[model samples]
Target: MLAALAVVALATVSGGAAGGWVASRDGAPGGTPASAAPVPAELVTAAGKTVPGVVSVLVGGAGGASASGSGFAVDDQQHIITNDHILAKGRNGSVTVELPDGRRFAAEVVGREPRSDLAVLKVPPSAGLAALPLAKPGATRVGEPVLAVGSPLGLPGTVTAGIVSALDRQVRLGDNRHSAVQTDASINPGNSGGPLVNARGEVVGVNTAIATIDGNGSIGIGFAIPIDQVQQTADTIIGKGG
Candidate 1:
Protein backbone atom coordinates (compact mmCIF):
# COMPACT_ATOMS: atom_id res chain seq x y z
CA MET A 1 0.00 0.00 0.00
CA LEU A 2 2.82 2.37 0.80
CA ALA A 3 4.47 1.65 -2.53
CA ALA A 4 1.16 2.19 -4.32
CA LEU A 5 0.74 5.47 -2.50
CA ALA A 6 4.23 6.54 -3.46
CA VAL A 7 3.53 5.67 -7.11
CA VAL A 8 0.33 7.67 -7.09
CA ALA A 9 2.12 10.62 -5.44
CA LEU A 10 4.92 10.48 -7.98
CA ALA A 11 2.41 10.45 -10.81
CA THR A 12 0.65 13.47 -9.38
CA VAL A 13 3.86 15.42 -8.86
CA SER A 14 5.34 14.52 -12.22
CA GLY A 15 2.08 15.27 -14.01
CA GLY A 16 2.05 11.57 -15.08
CA ALA A 17 5.79 11.31 -15.65
CA ALA A 18 7.71 8.47 -13.98
CA GLY A 19 9.70 10.58 -11.47
CA GLY A 20 7.65 13.32 -9.89
CA TRP A 21 8.39 14.52 -6.37
CA VAL A 22 9.06 17.78 -4.60
CA ALA A 23 12.57 19.00 -5.30
CA SER A 24 14.79 19.03 -2.22
CA ARG A 25 18.33 19.98 -1.32
CA ASP A 26 20.94 17.30 -0.59
CA GLY A 27 18.24 14.63 -0.78
CA ALA A 28 17.08 15.57 2.71
CA PRO A 29 13.48 15.35 3.85
CA GLY A 30 13.31 19.06 4.82
CA GLY A 31 16.05 20.84 2.93
CA THR A 32 15.76 24.14 1.08
CA PRO A 33 15.73 24.33 -2.69
CA ALA A 34 18.28 26.42 -4.52
CA SER A 35 16.07 29.45 -4.68
CA ALA A 36 16.25 32.39 -2.21
CA ALA A 37 17.57 33.19 1.22
CA PRO A 38 15.66 34.35 4.28
CA VAL A 39 14.11 37.79 4.42
CA PRO A 40 15.85 40.51 6.46
CA ALA A 41 14.64 41.66 9.89
CA GLU A 42 13.85 45.24 8.93
CA LEU A 43 11.52 44.00 6.27
CA VAL A 44 9.79 41.71 8.79
CA THR A 45 8.98 44.56 11.17
CA ALA A 46 7.61 46.65 8.31
CA ALA A 47 5.49 43.71 7.28
CA GLY A 48 4.33 43.23 10.85
CA LYS A 49 2.57 46.55 10.52
CA THR A 50 -0.04 44.85 8.41
CA VAL A 51 -1.11 42.25 10.99
CA PRO A 52 -3.88 44.54 12.12
CA GLY A 53 -5.76 43.44 9.03
CA VAL A 54 -5.50 39.77 9.93
CA VAL A 55 -8.68 38.42 11.45
CA SER A 56 -10.31 35.48 13.19
CA VAL A 57 -12.84 33.37 11.29
CA LEU A 58 -16.00 31.87 12.78
CA VAL A 59 -17.99 29.28 10.87
CA GLY A 60 -21.41 28.34 12.15
CA GLY A 61 -24.63 26.57 11.31
CA ALA A 62 -28.32 27.42 11.83
CA GLY A 63 -28.17 26.06 15.37
CA GLY A 64 -24.66 27.44 16.10
CA ALA A 65 -22.31 24.58 15.27
CA SER A 66 -19.14 26.55 14.72
CA ALA A 67 -15.35 26.51 14.45
CA SER A 68 -12.79 29.32 14.55
CA GLY A 69 -9.41 30.09 13.03
CA SER A 70 -7.25 33.00 11.88
CA GLY A 71 -6.80 34.81 8.52
CA PHE A 72 -5.30 37.93 6.99
CA ALA A 73 -6.27 40.41 4.30
CA VAL A 74 -4.34 39.87 1.07
CA ASP A 75 -5.73 42.62 -1.16
CA ASP A 76 -6.85 46.18 -0.61
CA GLN A 77 -10.35 45.38 -1.84
CA GLN A 78 -10.99 43.40 1.35
CA HIS A 79 -9.82 40.09 -0.08
CA ILE A 80 -8.47 37.80 2.66
CA ILE A 81 -6.67 34.47 2.72
CA THR A 82 -7.31 31.63 5.18
CA ASN A 83 -7.40 27.85 5.49
CA ASP A 84 -10.11 26.06 3.49
CA HIS A 85 -10.89 23.87 6.48
CA ILE A 86 -11.87 27.00 8.34
CA LEU A 87 -14.70 27.47 5.90
CA ALA A 88 -15.43 23.84 5.06
CA LYS A 89 -18.93 23.95 6.52
CA GLY A 90 -20.19 25.80 3.45
CA ARG A 91 -20.92 29.50 2.84
CA ASN A 92 -23.70 29.96 5.38
CA GLY A 93 -21.14 31.36 7.84
CA SER A 94 -19.71 34.65 9.07
CA VAL A 95 -16.12 35.84 9.70
CA THR A 96 -14.93 38.44 12.15
CA VAL A 97 -11.67 40.33 11.73
CA GLU A 98 -10.12 42.22 14.63
CA LEU A 99 -7.96 45.11 13.57
CA PRO A 100 -4.84 46.11 15.51
CA ASP A 101 -6.71 49.12 16.82
CA GLY A 102 -9.22 46.80 18.50
CA ARG A 103 -11.89 47.17 15.83
CA ARG A 104 -13.81 44.32 14.23
CA PHE A 105 -15.82 43.67 11.06
CA ALA A 106 -17.93 40.89 9.61
CA ALA A 107 -16.83 39.15 6.41
CA GLU A 108 -18.09 36.66 3.82
CA VAL A 109 -16.51 33.86 1.84
CA VAL A 110 -15.21 34.75 -1.61
CA GLY A 111 -13.69 31.46 -2.74
CA ARG A 112 -12.03 28.34 -1.34
CA GLU A 113 -9.50 25.76 -2.58
CA PRO A 114 -9.60 22.64 -0.44
CA ARG A 115 -7.00 20.84 -2.51
CA SER A 116 -4.48 23.40 -1.31
CA ASP A 117 -6.14 24.14 2.03
CA LEU A 118 -6.67 27.80 1.25
CA ALA A 119 -9.74 30.09 1.21
CA VAL A 120 -10.31 33.68 0.13
CA LEU A 121 -12.79 35.92 1.93
CA LYS A 122 -14.43 39.25 1.21
CA VAL A 123 -15.18 41.94 3.76
CA PRO A 124 -16.00 45.62 3.48
CA PRO A 125 -13.01 47.89 3.05
CA SER A 126 -14.54 49.89 5.85
CA ALA A 127 -13.25 47.14 8.07
CA GLY A 128 -9.91 48.96 7.99
CA LEU A 129 -8.14 46.22 6.20
CA ALA A 130 -4.40 46.19 5.68
CA ALA A 131 -3.01 43.59 3.33
CA LEU A 132 0.37 41.92 3.65
CA PRO A 133 2.75 41.49 0.75
CA LEU A 134 3.37 37.93 -0.38
CA ALA A 135 6.97 36.72 -0.38
CA LYS A 136 8.42 34.14 -2.70
CA PRO A 137 8.01 30.70 -1.22
CA GLY A 138 10.88 29.25 -3.20
CA ALA A 139 13.17 31.55 -1.24
CA THR A 140 12.60 29.98 2.15
CA ARG A 141 15.71 28.49 3.74
CA VAL A 142 16.29 26.08 6.61
CA GLY A 143 17.51 27.60 9.91
CA GLU A 144 16.00 31.00 9.13
CA PRO A 145 13.96 32.63 11.86
CA VAL A 146 10.23 33.16 11.36
CA LEU A 147 7.27 34.57 13.20
CA ALA A 148 3.66 33.40 13.28
CA VAL A 149 0.90 35.89 14.03
CA GLY A 150 -2.59 34.69 14.78
CA SER A 151 -5.30 34.28 17.39
CA PRO A 152 -4.01 31.13 18.98
CA LEU A 153 -6.59 29.36 21.10
CA GLY A 154 -8.82 32.40 20.51
CA LEU A 155 -6.36 34.82 22.06
CA PRO A 156 -6.20 37.70 19.58
CA GLY A 157 -2.91 38.99 18.17
CA THR A 158 -0.73 36.26 19.61
CA VAL A 159 2.82 36.14 18.29
CA THR A 160 5.36 33.30 18.39
CA ALA A 161 8.85 32.86 17.01
CA GLY A 162 10.89 29.92 15.73
CA ILE A 163 13.19 28.79 12.97
CA VAL A 164 12.43 27.24 9.64
CA SER A 165 13.05 23.60 10.44
CA ALA A 166 12.79 22.43 6.85
CA LEU A 167 11.50 23.29 3.42
CA ASP A 168 9.56 21.53 0.68
CA ARG A 169 7.82 19.15 3.07
CA GLN A 170 5.08 16.93 1.60
CA VAL A 171 1.95 16.27 3.64
CA ARG A 172 -1.41 14.67 3.05
CA LEU A 173 -4.73 16.51 3.19
CA GLY A 174 -7.73 14.36 2.36
CA ASP A 175 -6.88 12.74 -0.99
CA ASN A 176 -4.51 15.50 -2.11
CA ARG A 177 -0.81 15.92 -1.44
CA HIS A 178 0.60 19.30 -0.41
CA SER A 179 4.12 20.70 -0.32
CA ALA A 180 4.62 22.92 2.71
CA VAL A 181 7.19 24.89 4.71
CA GLN A 182 8.06 23.30 8.01
CA THR A 183 8.92 25.38 11.07
CA ASP A 184 9.25 25.18 14.86
CA ALA A 185 7.01 28.19 15.34
CA SER A 186 4.63 26.82 17.97
CA ILE A 187 1.35 26.93 16.11
CA ASN A 188 -1.75 25.94 18.08
CA PRO A 189 -5.23 24.90 17.03
CA GLY A 190 -6.50 28.46 16.56
CA ASN A 191 -3.36 29.43 14.66
CA SER A 192 -4.58 27.83 11.45
CA GLY A 193 -4.73 30.17 8.43
CA GLY A 194 -2.48 32.83 9.97
CA PRO A 195 0.51 34.25 8.16
CA LEU A 196 3.99 32.84 8.76
CA VAL A 197 6.26 35.81 8.12
CA ASN A 198 9.99 35.78 7.72
CA ALA A 199 12.28 38.04 9.68
CA ARG A 200 11.50 40.78 7.21
CA GLY A 201 7.80 40.44 7.87
CA GLU A 202 6.97 39.22 4.36
CA VAL A 203 4.52 36.36 4.34
CA VAL A 204 6.37 33.22 3.33
CA GLY A 205 3.77 30.71 4.47
CA VAL A 206 0.38 30.20 6.11
CA ASN A 207 0.32 28.37 9.43
CA THR A 208 -1.49 25.05 8.98
CA ALA A 209 -0.67 22.28 11.48
CA ILE A 210 1.62 21.22 14.29
CA ALA A 211 3.00 17.83 15.25
CA THR A 212 1.69 16.58 18.56
CA ILE A 213 3.25 13.88 20.72
CA ASP A 214 0.51 13.03 23.20
CA GLY A 215 -2.31 14.93 21.56
CA ASN A 216 -1.39 17.93 23.69
CA GLY A 217 0.72 20.68 22.05
CA SER A 218 3.48 21.36 19.58
CA ILE A 219 6.64 19.29 19.78
CA GLY A 220 8.68 21.90 17.92
CA ILE A 221 7.35 20.80 14.53
CA GLY A 222 4.80 22.79 12.58
CA PHE A 223 3.87 23.31 8.94
CA ALA A 224 2.50 26.08 6.77
CA ILE A 225 1.30 26.22 3.20
CA PRO A 226 3.87 27.90 1.01
CA ILE A 227 3.03 31.42 -0.15
CA ASP A 228 3.53 30.64 -3.81
CA GLN A 229 0.73 28.10 -3.82
CA VAL A 230 -1.31 30.40 -1.60
CA GLN A 231 -1.06 33.18 -4.20
CA GLN A 232 -2.09 30.89 -7.03
CA THR A 233 -4.96 29.45 -5.02
CA ALA A 234 -6.11 32.89 -3.91
CA ASP A 235 -6.08 34.11 -7.48
CA THR A 236 -8.22 31.20 -8.53
CA ILE A 237 -10.60 31.82 -5.66
CA ILE A 238 -10.93 35.47 -6.63
CA GLY A 239 -11.71 34.26 -10.13
CA LYS A 240 -14.66 32.33 -8.60
CA GLY A 241 -13.11 28.88 -8.87
CA GLY A 242 -12.56 28.20 -5.13
Candidate 2:
Protein backbone atom coordinates (compact mmCIF):
# COMPACT_ATOMS: atom_id res chain seq x y z
CA MET A 1 0.00 0.00 0.00
CA LEU A 2 2.81 2.42 0.78
CA ALA A 3 4.48 1.82 -2.57
CA ALA A 4 1.18 2.18 -4.33
CA LEU A 5 0.62 5.48 -2.55
CA ALA A 6 3.94 6.75 -3.77
CA VAL A 7 2.97 5.83 -7.30
CA VAL A 8 -0.28 7.69 -6.78
CA ALA A 9 1.64 10.77 -5.73
CA LEU A 10 3.74 10.68 -8.87
CA ALA A 11 0.80 9.95 -11.11
CA THR A 12 -1.19 12.73 -9.51
CA VAL A 13 1.64 15.14 -10.31
CA SER A 14 1.53 13.89 -13.90
CA GLY A 15 -2.25 14.20 -14.06
CA GLY A 16 -2.45 10.66 -15.37
CA ALA A 17 -1.24 7.11 -14.95
CA ALA A 18 2.31 8.05 -16.01
CA GLY A 19 4.81 9.13 -13.30
CA GLY A 20 8.29 10.62 -12.81
CA TRP A 21 11.70 9.55 -11.52
CA VAL A 22 14.41 11.43 -9.63
CA ALA A 23 18.01 10.47 -10.31
CA SER A 24 21.12 12.62 -10.81
CA ARG A 25 23.82 12.75 -13.46
CA ASP A 26 26.84 13.62 -11.37
CA GLY A 27 30.08 12.25 -9.99
CA ALA A 28 32.79 13.05 -7.41
CA PRO A 29 34.39 16.49 -7.50
CA GLY A 30 37.83 17.86 -6.67
CA GLY A 31 36.65 19.21 -3.29
CA THR A 32 37.55 22.74 -4.25
CA PRO A 33 36.07 25.78 -2.48
CA ALA A 34 33.01 27.44 -3.98
CA SER A 35 32.76 31.06 -5.10
CA ALA A 36 32.74 33.39 -2.13
CA ALA A 37 30.62 36.21 -3.43
CA PRO A 38 27.90 37.18 -1.03
CA VAL A 39 24.37 36.31 -2.03
CA PRO A 40 23.15 38.99 -4.38
CA ALA A 41 19.62 40.02 -5.24
CA GLU A 42 20.22 38.93 -8.81
CA LEU A 43 20.88 35.38 -7.74
CA VAL A 44 17.66 35.46 -5.79
CA THR A 45 15.83 36.84 -8.76
CA ALA A 46 17.33 34.18 -10.96
CA ALA A 47 15.99 31.49 -8.72
CA GLY A 48 12.54 32.97 -8.94
CA LYS A 49 12.70 32.90 -12.72
CA THR A 50 14.20 29.44 -12.97
CA VAL A 51 12.03 27.28 -10.76
CA PRO A 52 8.94 27.76 -12.87
CA GLY A 53 10.64 26.48 -15.98
CA VAL A 54 11.66 23.20 -14.35
CA VAL A 55 9.31 20.27 -13.96
CA SER A 56 9.12 16.88 -12.32
CA VAL A 57 9.55 14.04 -14.82
CA LEU A 58 7.35 11.10 -14.00
CA VAL A 59 7.38 7.85 -15.98
CA GLY A 60 5.36 4.67 -15.82
CA GLY A 61 6.24 1.41 -17.56
CA ALA A 62 5.13 -2.20 -17.74
CA GLY A 63 3.85 -4.09 -14.72
CA GLY A 64 3.14 -0.97 -12.64
CA ALA A 65 6.73 0.25 -12.68
CA SER A 66 7.33 3.97 -12.20
CA ALA A 67 10.13 6.50 -11.54
CA SER A 68 10.50 10.24 -10.96
CA GLY A 69 13.15 12.85 -11.72
CA SER A 70 13.64 16.46 -12.83
CA GLY A 71 13.86 18.34 -16.14
CA PHE A 72 13.75 21.89 -17.51
CA ALA A 73 12.38 23.72 -20.52
CA VAL A 74 14.76 24.41 -23.39
CA ASP A 75 12.43 26.16 -25.84
CA ASP A 76 9.05 27.77 -26.33
CA GLN A 77 7.70 24.87 -28.35
CA GLN A 78 7.35 22.80 -25.16
CA HIS A 79 10.56 20.80 -25.58
CA ILE A 80 12.06 19.57 -22.31
CA ILE A 81 15.42 17.87 -21.84
CA THR A 82 16.39 15.10 -19.46
CA ASN A 83 18.82 12.19 -19.11
CA ASP A 84 18.27 9.16 -21.27
CA HIS A 85 18.96 6.83 -18.34
CA ILE A 86 16.44 8.67 -16.18
CA LEU A 87 13.77 8.08 -18.76
CA ALA A 88 14.95 4.53 -19.35
CA LYS A 89 13.99 3.46 -15.86
CA GLY A 90 10.42 3.29 -17.05
CA ARG A 91 10.92 2.34 -20.66
CA ASN A 92 7.93 0.06 -20.61
CA GLY A 93 5.54 2.98 -20.07
CA SER A 94 5.00 6.63 -20.91
CA VAL A 95 6.50 9.89 -19.64
CA THR A 96 4.72 12.74 -17.85
CA VAL A 97 5.84 16.31 -17.30
CA GLU A 98 4.47 18.07 -14.20
CA LEU A 99 4.96 21.78 -13.82
CA PRO A 100 5.26 23.78 -10.64
CA ASP A 101 1.92 25.44 -11.30
CA GLY A 102 0.02 22.15 -10.91
CA ARG A 103 -0.38 21.79 -14.65
CA ARG A 104 0.46 18.40 -16.08
CA PHE A 105 1.00 17.03 -19.58
CA ALA A 106 1.92 13.79 -21.22
CA ALA A 107 5.47 13.62 -22.55
CA GLU A 108 6.73 11.66 -25.50
CA VAL A 109 10.33 10.94 -26.29
CA VAL A 110 11.14 12.94 -29.39
CA GLY A 111 14.77 11.89 -29.58
CA ARG A 112 17.24 9.97 -27.47
CA GLU A 113 20.98 9.66 -27.76
CA PRO A 114 22.22 7.06 -25.32
CA ARG A 115 25.78 7.87 -26.29
CA SER A 116 25.39 11.42 -25.03
CA ASP A 117 23.12 10.33 -22.22
CA LEU A 118 20.67 13.02 -23.24
CA ALA A 119 17.06 12.95 -24.40
CA VAL A 120 14.47 15.49 -25.49
CA LEU A 121 10.77 15.31 -24.67
CA LYS A 122 7.72 16.98 -26.14
CA VAL A 123 4.64 18.31 -24.42
CA PRO A 124 1.73 20.37 -25.62
CA PRO A 125 2.20 24.13 -25.49
CA SER A 126 -0.78 25.17 -23.47
CA ALA A 127 0.59 28.40 -22.05
CA GLY A 128 3.33 30.92 -22.55
CA LEU A 129 6.29 29.14 -21.03
CA ALA A 130 9.47 31.08 -20.43
CA ALA A 131 12.25 28.78 -21.60
CA LEU A 132 15.37 28.91 -19.53
CA PRO A 133 18.25 30.52 -21.38
CA LEU A 134 21.11 28.27 -22.41
CA ALA A 135 24.57 29.73 -22.25
CA LYS A 136 26.90 29.81 -25.21
CA PRO A 137 29.47 27.11 -25.67
CA GLY A 138 32.43 27.52 -23.30
CA ALA A 139 30.47 29.94 -21.16
CA THR A 140 31.33 28.04 -17.97
CA ARG A 141 34.38 29.11 -16.02
CA VAL A 142 35.98 27.68 -12.91
CA GLY A 143 34.95 29.25 -9.60
CA GLU A 144 31.78 30.67 -11.11
CA PRO A 145 28.70 30.63 -8.90
CA VAL A 146 25.86 28.32 -9.88
CA LEU A 147 22.60 26.98 -8.58
CA ALA A 148 21.10 23.51 -8.99
CA VAL A 149 17.32 23.18 -8.82
CA GLY A 150 15.49 19.86 -8.76
CA SER A 151 13.49 17.43 -6.66
CA PRO A 152 15.78 15.48 -4.39
CA LEU A 153 14.39 12.45 -2.61
CA GLY A 154 11.05 13.32 -4.14
CA LEU A 155 11.16 16.83 -2.65
CA PRO A 156 9.96 19.24 -5.32
CA GLY A 157 11.19 22.80 -5.77
CA THR A 158 14.38 21.99 -3.94
CA VAL A 159 17.36 24.24 -4.56
CA THR A 160 21.09 23.98 -3.83
CA ALA A 161 23.92 26.35 -4.67
CA GLY A 162 27.57 25.75 -5.52
CA ILE A 163 30.36 26.69 -7.91
CA VAL A 164 31.96 25.43 -11.06
CA SER A 165 34.92 23.33 -9.98
CA ALA A 166 36.28 22.27 -13.35
CA LEU A 167 35.60 21.92 -17.07
CA ASP A 168 36.10 19.37 -19.86
CA ARG A 169 35.72 16.49 -17.45
CA GLN A 170 35.40 13.07 -19.01
CA VAL A 171 32.93 10.93 -17.12
CA ARG A 172 31.56 7.56 -18.10
CA LEU A 173 27.98 6.40 -17.79
CA GLY A 174 28.02 2.75 -18.75
CA ASP A 175 29.84 2.55 -22.08
CA ASN A 176 29.17 6.18 -22.94
CA ARG A 177 31.79 8.85 -22.30
CA HIS A 178 30.91 12.54 -22.06
CA SER A 179 32.93 15.71 -21.49
CA ALA A 180 31.12 17.37 -18.63
CA VAL A 181 31.09 20.48 -16.44
CA GLN A 182 32.00 19.74 -12.85
CA THR A 183 30.43 21.53 -9.88
CA ASP A 184 30.46 21.35 -6.11
CA ALA A 185 26.68 21.44 -5.94
CA SER A 186 24.67 19.12 -3.71
CA ILE A 187 23.21 16.95 -6.45
CA ASN A 188 21.45 13.71 -5.58
CA PRO A 189 19.40 10.95 -7.12
CA GLY A 190 16.41 13.09 -8.02
CA ASN A 191 18.30 15.94 -9.64
CA SER A 192 18.90 14.32 -13.01
CA GLY A 193 17.88 16.23 -16.18
CA GLY A 194 17.60 19.59 -14.38
CA PRO A 195 19.54 22.74 -15.14
CA LEU A 196 22.67 24.15 -13.55
CA VAL A 197 22.22 27.88 -13.94
CA ASN A 198 24.66 30.71 -13.49
CA ALA A 199 24.13 33.53 -11.05
CA ARG A 200 22.28 35.41 -13.76
CA GLY A 201 19.79 32.52 -14.28
CA GLU A 202 21.35 31.46 -17.58
CA VAL A 203 21.73 27.74 -17.97
CA VAL A 204 25.29 26.60 -18.39
CA GLY A 205 24.75 22.89 -18.13
CA VAL A 206 22.22 20.16 -17.55
CA ASN A 207 22.48 18.54 -14.12
CA THR A 208 23.10 14.90 -15.11
CA ALA A 209 25.45 12.90 -12.89
CA ILE A 210 26.76 12.85 -9.33
CA ALA A 211 29.55 10.91 -7.69
CA THR A 212 28.56 9.10 -4.56
CA ILE A 213 30.65 7.48 -1.87
CA ASP A 214 29.57 3.96 -1.06
CA GLY A 215 26.37 4.64 -2.96
CA ASN A 216 25.17 6.80 -0.08
CA GLY A 217 24.42 10.07 -1.96
CA SER A 218 25.97 13.36 -3.00
CA ILE A 219 29.14 14.62 -1.34
CA GLY A 220 29.36 17.97 -3.05
CA ILE A 221 30.43 16.38 -6.35
CA GLY A 222 28.29 16.66 -9.43
CA PHE A 223 28.50 16.82 -13.22
CA ALA A 224 26.40 18.49 -15.88
CA ILE A 225 26.24 18.24 -19.67
CA PRO A 226 27.38 21.45 -21.27
CA ILE A 227 24.60 23.40 -22.93
CA ASP A 228 26.42 23.18 -26.24
CA GLN A 229 25.89 19.46 -26.40
CA VAL A 230 22.32 19.91 -25.27
CA GLN A 231 21.67 22.27 -28.13
CA GLN A 232 23.26 20.10 -30.79
CA THR A 233 21.38 16.98 -29.83
CA ALA A 234 18.15 18.82 -29.16
CA ASP A 235 18.17 20.51 -32.52
CA THR A 236 18.74 17.24 -34.26
CA ILE A 237 15.95 15.63 -32.30
CA ILE A 238 13.58 18.45 -33.05
CA GLY A 239 14.39 18.31 -36.70
CA LYS A 240 14.16 14.55 -37.00
CA GLY A 241 12.10 13.31 -34.07
CA GLY A 242 9.37 15.82 -34.64
Highest lDDT: give the candidate number. 2
How many angstroms is residue 55 displaced in model 2 relative to the true structure, after the best TM-score fit? 0.5
Number of clashes in every candidate structure?
Answer: 3, 24
Q: For residue 24, give model 2's deviation from the true position in Å.
A: 20
Give the top-scoring candidate (TM-score): 2
Model 2 spans > 4 angstroms off: 1-38
Query: Model 2, poorest ten-residue lDDT window?
Result: 2-11
- Residue by residue across 120-227, what tens digits does model 2's lDDT show? 988888844579998888778999989999876666677888899999988877777788898998877667888899988999998888765444445577889898
Q: What overall lDDT goes with each candidate model?
A: 0.71, 0.77
Question: How well does model 1 score by local distance difference test?
Answer: 0.71
